[model samples]
Target: MAVSKKRDKNVYKAPRNIGKPESENPKWLIPTALTMLIVGVVWIVIYYITQANYPLPIANWNIVVGFVFLGTGMVLLTRWK
Candidate 1:
């Protein structure tokens, strides 16, 4: 058998950037998002577990806080890519 020596006709250029740009994402972004999501769930669970008057002693506002954290985490997750 003989080996071929022809080169592929593609322009070869070395990558100029050392690493990914900041616009891509940070190492902590996903973790932070996950934390927010988990914390949000825990916060809501505590509120419910305590009858919504043991943790913060506030009524009806517990749901709002949980939703806000969850929403923020979801938004952050969307920006991860």
Candidate 2:
């Protein structure tokens, strides 16, 4: 015959955040994200249109800047809500 051990009732349990309202996003989030996406697209477009002769003295840097802006905006947007 084998004896079974009883379960412990005092085990620590994390609280469930049920019935909690969803948090609202910051007011600036949407606009800023949109602006960055737009700017990135526009920068690429302008670079192609001008044959990489406009925006900045260095042709390659323009693209880099545009991508940085886009990345930043995306990161900010993810934090929203």
Candidate 3:
């Protein structure tokens, strides 16, 4: 049996932005996400540690506030691509 040494010349090329540094990621994405997440957790933590003083002194409002921040962060993550 004999074999042929022919190769396919057709190749696919990806878009330019695929490897560009500018298309890596949005500048405020990570920072904003982190800020919301961290602030939410910290606020809840502080609320728990300090009953009614500093930050928000409202009763049980801290939970709602924390959740809002956390939810916003999660929403932002969805549009990362």
- For all predicted structures, in order, the TM-scores are 0.67, 0.69, 0.65
User: Between candidates 1 and 2, which one is better according to lDDT?
Assistant: 1
lDDT of each: 0.87, 0.85, 0.82
Model 2 deviation from the true structure expressed as Cα RMSD, one decimal place: 4.2
Clashing pairs in 1: none
List ranges where model 2 is wrong by over 4 Å. Answer: 1-22
lDDT of 1 by residue, 1-81 (tens): 999899988978888875666576889999999999998899899998988785576688888889889999999999876
The local distance difference test score of model 3 is 0.82
Estimate the TM-score for candidate 2.
Answer: 0.69
Query: Distance from true position, residue 45, model 3, in Å?
Result: 0.3
Candidate 2 lDDT by residue in tens digits, 1-81: 999999999999877876665787879889989899889888878887899987776868989988988898899888876
Q: What C-alpha lDDT, on a 0 to 100 scale, does residue 46 get in candidate 2?
A: 87
For candidate 1, the TM-score is: 0.67
| Candidate number achieving the greatest lDDT relative to the actual structure | 1
Candidate 3 residue pairs that clash: none
Q: Can you write out model 3's per-residue Cα lDDT over 5-55, one digit (the tens) per residue?
A: 787777677787775465556889988988999999898888878874646
